[model samples]
Target: MRFSLLLMVCALCSVSQAALTFILGAHENVCFGVFTDQPRTSISYYFAVQSGGAFDVDYTIKNPRGEVIVTEDKQRQGDFIINADIAGEYELCFSNSMSTYAEKVIDFEIKVENDKNDFKANMPDQPNAKPKAHIENMGKTVDKIDQKLDELLRAIQYYKTRNNRNQATVKSTESRIYYFSIFEVLLMVGMAGLQITVVQLFFKGSRKQLV
Candidate 1:
């Protein structure tokens, strides 16, 4: 029983996922690392800037051999998946160097998925064990269900990030509109006052000339 429980724990650890939130200062760069021991593994990442500096940032993904796998500039959100070709530490980086004063609120996720074929091959031979085969099939079904649940969670996070970005945009637009309207009203009032003053001076000059 203990061995079975340990196997379960190890299996769970093999499927890794993380959701992280961080504040990036203006003109700052942050990097994260993920290590894998096998090639052909899938690395998935998603990121969104929730607020500040146009909700945009720059990102880069580097492989174990220091080769660039992916790079994007001035992006607000993204989802990416890449296959690891070598077994080592991979670096993922985010940069806010384009922003001079705005600090960014960043939300991101990283997930590492192993090859399914390897998992299937690792199962012991059970040619004469019907009940064990059935249980193994059930376990696979449960894993599929868990994957679906992870997808749902990711979708929810994506929507939440989008909502926050939209709200911030709306608030910024409203503020600009309010300030512009005030400026327009003040300009119109000043023009009217200037016109009235000019008319009064004209009439005074005309009266003096007639006298």
Candidate 2:
């Protein structure tokens, strides 16, 4: 029985990672799923709005029992980590129902961490077994490296999202500025023509009165 339990735990340690991009239309909502078989499993997610209405969307996460774990409105980007105490299918949803005309571009990722290594490290040592101090130290080092890599990846994604938003803003501003400048020039020319016409009419009337 113990061996079977260990095997099950090891099987659960297989990590899953996925990145998704989707379009949410006006007044629409979308949902996705992730499944786990063990309690207290680590789940991480990150999401950003690449474009669309107000660059924001509403999001919700639910556990296996359909209990809401997290919900937010008008969020442009987010990162979250949670431990699932109940093993089953988890739901993630995004809503754009508040928007009337603008569609949204969304980029998101989900990652699950398996705990088999930690479980093995905590098991009792057998008789005549070698000291595990060096092995434990090596495992710790590897964990640290993995954590650093995850952080780096998150940072890169954040910067990319920020760059996309900045470019969109710049383009929108440039378009408005161009249109405003053209309108200003046309207004000035129209006023100058009106003023010249008025002056010419006044001189003509004065000449007629003098005659």
Candidate 3:
């Protein structure tokens, strides 16, 4: 049973890591690309060159209105991490409503990080490079990484279960709190009504005695 559980965990980790990342480059070796693994998310962007030889990127975010939504100007060979608030068909386009100008070839390393998986996957910037270290060390590192990945996968499962349980607990607590607040309001109204009645009766009795 333990081995089966471990195998299942390993499979889940592998799938998450094998996710596809999309990238696009325009004008030969000027490899301008954005990375995203989620198919449901799409992005559109427009690129233009500035006066100072820097790059300008204007973007219309997910579910674009066929008009510009956001702009990223003067970007150079580095990461452009997109932090999205809601999940949908997010897109990024390059070079629309602007000049299609670019300089010499530039290299880029884009990463598409996902949040819904149990595995801590890795995508090498240059996967075709010569193998590092001796073959013996490479084997050892592979074994160690597999062990760590197994442990991480188990942790992800544990945390996911914990989060679900906590959500239910929070909802129940909130309902109780709401009812308690309503009860408090009703009690205050009843007390106020009683006080007003007592005050009116006291005044009426005093007036009758005086008469």
Give me the candidate number with maximum lDDT: 2
Looking at candidate 2, what is the lDDT of residue 73? 99
TM-score, structure 3 vs. true: 0.32
- Worst 10-residue lDDT window, candidate 3: 1-10
- Ranking of candidates on TM-score, top first: 1, 2, 3
Per-candidate TM-scores read 0.85, 0.85, 0.32
Total clashing pairs in model 1: 0
RMSD of 3: 19.8
RMSD (Cα, Å) for all candidates, in order, is 6.2, 6.2, 19.8
Task: Put down candidate 2 lDDT per residue, 1-211, tens digits, no spaces.
Answer: 0001011223535567888788889988888777777776787889999998579999999887999999999999989998877877777888999999999999988887666566766678789876788767887898899889999998898888899899999999999999999999999999999999999999999999999
Question: Candidate 1 on 168-199: residue-level lDDT in tens?
Answer: 88999999999999999999999999999999
Error of 1 at 8 (Å): 17
- Please state the error at residue 160 of candidate 2 in Å: 0.4
Q: Could you tell me the lDDT of residue 84 within candidate 1?
A: 75
Candidate 2: residue 103 lDDT (0-100): 93
lDDT, candidates in the order shown: 0.81, 0.82, 0.40
